[model samples]
Target: MLMYCEDPSSFCSLVLNITSATGNFIGNQLDLLYLGWVASLLYPAILVFIILPSLILVLLYISAFLLYIYMRRKKVYNVLNETLHRDPWASGRYLISLLWDAHGYIWHGYEVRGLENLPDEGPCLIIYYHGAIPIDIYYLVARTILTKGRLIHCVGDRFLEKVPGWKVILEAFHITPGTITSCVQTLSENNILSISPGGVREAQFSDHNYQLMWGNRTGFAKVAIESKSPVVPLFTENLREAFRTVSWPQRLWIALYEKLRFPIAPIYGGFPVKLRAHLGEPIYHREGETVEELAQRIRASLNSLIQRKQKLPGNILRALLARFYEPTKNE
Candidate 1:
């Protein structure tokens, strides 16, 4: 029976010859079916263990290739900026152009409204309500480059200087906040200067509700007064939605990170999201304005602009649609 079973055709012939042999033949067939079922279940496990890692490696390779292309283009710009010692404003504009071109014109998402209102040439203090993420600075930089080819001296947190390669890049961009004297000098040079009064505190506490972290942003007004630069009130539409903040508990934990002088809030918005930046009418500084009064007025102007921009139906629709597209511009 065992030998006959090994050769199934012979077993079937023998089973036809004897009815009792049919039961043994049926049992053997059932055992074979059971074995095939067991093998089918285990086959997928073997393939996953042996093949998945290789597939992941291939994906990693593709990602690396894209990153290499991005880095190489950026390196060329850096070399050009260094070799030419280009005018600061021109250099900034060139960089923005390079980034925009590389990213396939992502900056077009911005529906700029007040370019006509920006001065053709002058010293100005541009105060924009900052987004929770740092992309707001990039948008401001891009706009400045587009209009005047002038670099805006951005006052960033002191901690940014501590980052390894970031320090050198920030310095190249003429970003400095180490001292009031340096700030004053930059402003005196007729270079545009931008400040986000909310700073790190706003980034940490702004939550994802589109609320401004600014309670009373007096420092920017004071800077405007000291520097004698006219205040430009800028507003960004859908900037916060570009990078949503994490949960409140996570934000609280991040608020405790001390490597930075302030809390290191984790920014959650990035690729596949659209952002828009807009410049409002410039709020000219009053000659005899006290710092407190100027600050109040600047805040009021920014809030009003925010409310107006937010109410625009087109802006709101674009903001929602931006969630699906990757940003190509500096922001």
Candidate 2:
């Protein structure tokens, strides 16, 4: 089956907001949860991605909104005039994950493969290619948790750790500092941890070839080895098409961002592009492998996954025009 985006109408057009609000019509499906349960999930995404003008506040607002709705409609929360209330990390993270899943299915046509490879129970290290926005990580966690019933301790960049909004969400997800200590701790505790070895560099520099800038980043492997965790290589296809990085002066842009904290390289595109995440079999600890050697093993696995699922997410106009012109040429 073929799928591609179409030009918007001259007047009205399909947009993400309209697509998000489409949930209001699915009240019946939500009703199965009852108002409290449903509110717990929907309110967080709405408040976070919509209202707070930020992300972390989403955790608290989700609870408050759900409570208010439950009390008014179902009568609940009995708590006071609350400015803020922190929730269990799991609760907030679960809500955000659910939103990503819904959005992935309804908007991006997201798909995941190879779940049988994950360990039945134990700390596992998951490494993947990074995208400009990294929403694909959310998609992965959302689906993995639902299918595998496990929460992954994802790692984030130093820059995102500073974004006040992302700071909260990242912390709630057990992603912090991107340091060896945190990574080792996550895996040592027998919890799955996910990190993108390519990190911000790849996120900013990716191109048509799906380049991964994880050069010399072997610390993740060292940590995994120290924790005796198996490494799972994963890659989500079509990230480059989802958000194309700006070319020319790319290095200069990254330099300025590092020195001045201004966002650079100016990438765009969050369209409903198709996404396929490939999860590879675990690379268990090797007795004598160095950190670099172990990292290379994971990298090779990830590259294999990327190569297998990679596609251009072709231009809609180009595909249509070529099709229309095909028969004429043959004739």
Candidate 3:
């Protein structure tokens, strides 16, 4: 009896310890119950509030992208068709050119030299800096036709296709969008193609500072390289004064106008101002040059040309009276 009684107390203590451990394990589950309940409440709210809105935004972005592609395709097709339509009035551009020539002569006593610098034949990529209203384009086109007898197709802004009167004007001038494909075709066919890499932003923001606004626009270099064409850099003076762009509600308004492809700028004096244009020596592309390097080279060339325009001697009043008093060939 004594031998069995000695271990009975120790055995009783072990049994009590096991009971205490089992009770604490059940108590820990009760403590976690509140946290589990909170997670269940939050999971549904997060899915409905945060995840749902993000999904809707994603869908909207996709829709907008598809719409932009469709409109761009439609515009390209229409422009190609218009290009095929021949202008029966071969002298149409000639008359228009004369008008601008007279206008430039009267206004700013405009003088555009360097017609000799342009090649007498095709496949020339006429890359120029955009002035206030691209008055340079008109001056050069008219002068080339009047002087060299070559028609130049300018690469216009994407917004031109949507302009009220500009659609007709674009078709008449054989202008197309500045897409890579268009440039390639224009150059390969040995046609004179003029492009402004800076485009509308450059035109809108110019304040007689002939700085190149072509931000990272290197595609033109690729086109020129692939076409194996000589690039002709050209620029003009006092273009901003001729027809200055006006802006109201500056930033927000301009941003909205851009989205809609609508330019909303208040225009000031047009015509009868001092005008000047200069065509630079043609820059030939070396084989295997990177587009970035070529673009920088082109930018440097245009800047040099603009700096020269500043040095030329010009008198507004005398040049104006000289042109206004002269008789037209028709007269």
Candidate 4:
């Protein structure tokens, strides 16, 4: 065999021929497979990302328009019948309640304890352990509306006011800052004031659900004392299930975005979760107690209530039983 193929040119030609044939076969196969893959993916990808999204947007717009029309008609009738006395806040609250109910009933699948502790009448300060998400506020609003048409003014951060449409929504809900003047004005109007003393730091730090952000929150108690309002300690379990907050790079990005006045927390949920809020017995302000003393007392009350609840076994049976139990009315 070596003698027969002694010419170097002949051997080189044989090797080149084999290599060219192998390359051509692989190239042809790849082209055929790639073409088939493209044909299979093209239509489905277009339908999913483009056409489907457009259809969803159109349907949402039409639904929103119809809802607005229905609400407007009801409002006009209420005004004409002199049933509502042209109160926009009342109308807004009614609409919000209706919307809330339609999506999901209040405490329908959740449980609320300590409702008996909430005052039946008069200006009071309701402070709760704020959750990672702000769903606790919605639960409080729903509860307040059902119990008494007493408006609950929330002391929110100045950052929320900077967001484009958020300022309007917050204002409509009578949510103000956790400032002294604002607290005094809100209480003087005979309206209940709700404050989460933990502010943004709590929301950021409480990555796990049900974990409180309040290590040192005394301003709420001071507000209650100065306003002569009783401090109502509130606790919400399972409220964190509504939405999970970003913990890492996403959290860092969100903080920066918030600084730029943008809502960076990406949250998506249908029909708000059935969050339950427990209102503890009121702690009245002493006649001449210092603000520090008042704050400490309020903190102690809240911390104790939360600790007691935490000791309970987090089992499905307990949750179901709680949901079925009716809350006792405040005396």
State every prediction's TM-score relative to the real structure: 0.65, 0.67, 0.64, 0.66
Return the clash pairs for model 2, or none.
70-75, 71-75, 71-76
What are the per-residue Cα lDDT tens digits for candidate 2 across 239-331? 666667677887798788778765578887876566767889889878988988888888888887766666443343332343224222122
Q: Rate the local accuracy (lDDT) of all candidates.
A: 0.65, 0.71, 0.71, 0.66
Give the better candidate number (1 or 4) by TM-score.
4
- In candidate 1, the residue pairs with backbone N, CA or C atoms under 3 Å apart (3 or more residues apart, or in different chains) clash, namely 89-149, 89-150, 89-151, 243-269, 274-322
TM-score of the candidate numbered 1?
0.65
Model 2, total clashes: 3
Give the candidate number with the greatest TM-score: 2
List where candidate 4 sits over 4 angstroms from the true fold.
1-86, 104-111, 249-274, 311-331
Per-model root-mean-square deviation over C-alphas: 11.7, 19.6, 21.1, 7.7
lDDT of 3 by residue, 1-331 (tens): 2223245469766776677798898788877887899888998999899899889977775675555444445533543355434554345565566666554544456677676777788788878877657876887787787667688889887777876787766776788886898789887988788988888777776554556789888988888898988888888755555666665556864686678765566556565665667778888888778889999999999988777654333233432443445323233
Model 1 ranges with Cα > 4 A deviation: 1-93, 100-104, 215-217, 254-260, 311-318, 322-331
Which residues of candidate 2, in runs, are more than 4 Å off? 1-87, 261-263, 312-331
